[model samples]
Target: MEIAIGVVVGAILAIAGFILGRSSGRSVGLSEGPLAGSPETDDHAALEDRSSSRESELNTVLVEAIGRVSAFLKTNVRKPLIEAGEAAGADELRERIEHALGALSDIDFFLEEPSMSRSGQSLVSLVENVAQEFSGDQDVRLRMQLASSPVRAVVSGPVMMDVLYLILHNASRFGGDSTIDIAVQAIDGRSLILVRDHGPGFSDEALQRAFDPFYSTSAEGLGLGLPHARSLIEQMGGQIELRNVSDGGAEVEVSFPSS
Candidate 1:
């Protein structure tokens, strides 16, 4: 009876030791082993991804909203100011205003239509006619060199008009009562318009920043003119660039893909 009781006690001790060792090994493995996917970790990763995506979407929406607002102000407020200036007996100012307004109107009209075809001849003629109408007393001279052959392009009329007017307006504004040389040429299978103004040229940084939305050097300017012009040109598969001439002025070059 004594031996049997000792044997039973020893057996019970061995069993307990084995269970304790197994339990310790399992705890250590759980602490040092490769991580297993859990609901909590998965939820955290998903939340982070969602947050990043939401932030990106919100930024996009904000940028688009800013653009729309800028457009509205340019059309409704800025253009009207030009018209009002014209009526206020400022002949030079009036001419500038009319030029700007006409360009804005053309852009508005062109964008209002969905499917529109534009004739290169008609566009060139329209621009020349408008320029002549507005160049009455301004010291700056207006000139147009149309292509020998009509360079047909698929464009929204108003958009192209706005682009042209913007370039012309900028040239006149900065040219400081000097003659502006306007020329049109065809190069590299693209129709190109060059507007050169004898004004204080901008630095490389300023030239680059001019394309940014709402960037302006003039305290009175709303700074949407160039950006809007660029948007219109790019919409029609064209490009606009500003470069300082070696003499002492700035030149704006616009290129349109040949249709």
Candidate 2:
């Protein structure tokens, strides 16, 4: 199933590249179609038109792919994974399902160019949800330090929730024998959330490439978690930063601009 999904994703990425290549005049034939034998100015004009059309076509392809992937995850992956886990009484099955769900969340945010509506969402509620989702199995302990007052951020609640989940998931996965700590506060009219784990601090290489897509320290990971979190936060007018604490841990700080 994983291989099948990888092939499908690879094909979609190739199609996207091909579309962009044609738009940029690399794959557009100069001697065959509308630009054939045309003067320089005419060729330029035609190319511009093709580029505009190609952009629209590319958006259509991305939207379609998003729909197909969402449907596939719901119908094929989620149900079977849940049932198998229940039948076999294995925690690993549930963990795999959660990881798959996280991947779907990333794809949903990374594609779909238009941002979702997230006006007037309570930061307090968002933080609560994130804590709940990550600790769903009741095994991982999360220490949430929330601010006293209500905090609101100008970002989609779901997007922020996923961001928190990704951060917490990473902290727990690498934390090993240490408890995870999360702090949520409002300062200077912005909502700030910090995640700290008492694990071995990131090495120099990790600090440089931690947020790069497909670059993972773990052999089994796809390395899209931090990248996806960063993209989603920036899209919503927020900022994310990662650093190692001086004492002994890795820290992730997320700031959402006030609505």
Candidate 3:
């Protein structure tokens, strides 16, 4: 039991370390950095490539092992513990366990390299649906500036909607009762989803660590929302940008290929 607990803890730490050490984004479609004629630079590049490869291999193994552990914990440990807690009226224990499980879910999403295949979906409809879903889930209002022409984006609609929903959810969570402004536009062969929140725009530190896992401006945040959102978007040939709107708000713009 000691060894089993140790392994589980180790695996969880491994996942945390992997994310905290994350640099250079995902391992796909990245351009080589700063090539020069110097032999020293070439040597450094070779070492970096090998290190990067090794890290990727470690991540794969860690996820497979941690996934099994997570499943077992959920079924054998988490459920029983939660039930016992409820029966004993150990509300604090149950809440702590539940919070850990929730953190694990976010970490799993943040760590995985998603392979999202795209199909042409109407960007406009997805936005509308996501807006509706958000409003239904919470007492938040979403205002839209949809394109005049129907824009078809080469992306999975469901995944995109989830990503959009997450963006809105974050806005609503932090932006208080202010209305969220979302704009869908097609520009330069790209489909853009712009989410702007009328909150205290990101601080300099927040902007700097915008997508870093486990970094959050809110005391209540576990902080993987934007990082996971970026991973999903990047996998599907999309990109997310963070900026402060000059007019006292935060803006997140996601772009994808327009079909």
Candidate 4:
């Protein structure tokens, strides 16, 4: 009996020592494990990705907004201001100055407000605002055929209008007849706006690089219109396409998925 009791106690001590040794070794192994470095590495990578995404977003907004304001100044303000001075008509000059002030106020609003943020707005209203942009241009005739009812979409209203304006502006620039045709329709759960210009059709290279930033065929342009327009549209989960119509001009189609 004494021998048997001694044997049992020795076995228990041996088992306890083995368990304690394994526990100590396992604790050390966990700290030195292959996956121990993963958490920190993954965290660093995630931070980098977020930073890159934010930088890209800011760059897109900066480029597009600056381009938009520059074009507005050139087309709507500069020439008018010069002409108002040369003509020396008080009433006309006052009107032009007032218009310039209003446009400047709009620029301030665009910069201060979240004009590029997404929201639900009437697609028809957006298109109308784009058409209004050409109201002062005598040579550019703007026409729109919108749906009988209001077509709703989820997008940034200001950004969408700007994009449409850019497309229309480009069309007028290239279109030979100085006439712009805009059509809006809702089909297959999407809102589609088509801007047609009777200008010379795009060449193969132009078609391929229509959305390439800073690529312009004309000497008089900054070439950021289509690229900015495309970026805004794509950010809103929409699409913009440039194609030549068989009727001898180019057509730009803007489509946004309806809410």
Off by over 4 Å in 2: 1-7, 10-115
- Best lDDT goes to which candidate? 3
- Relative to the true structure, candidate 1 reaches a TM of 0.55
Q: Highest TM-score, which number? A: 3
TM-score of each: 0.55, 0.63, 0.64, 0.58
**lDDT-better candidate, 1 vs 3:** 3
lDDT of 4 by residue, 106-144 (tens): 434322324568888888888887687666754688878
lDDT of 3 by residue, 43-65 (tens): 66776787688778667755654
lDDT of 2 by residue, 64-89 (tens): 54455545565555655656644564
Candidates in descending TM-score order: 3, 2, 4, 1
Model 4 residue runs over 4 Å out of place are 1-114
- Spell out the clash pairs found in candidate 2: none
**lDDT score at residue 216, model 2, on the 0-100 scale:** 65
Q: Which pairs clash in the backbone of model 4?
A: 175-199, 176-199
Q: Candidate 4 clash total?
A: 2
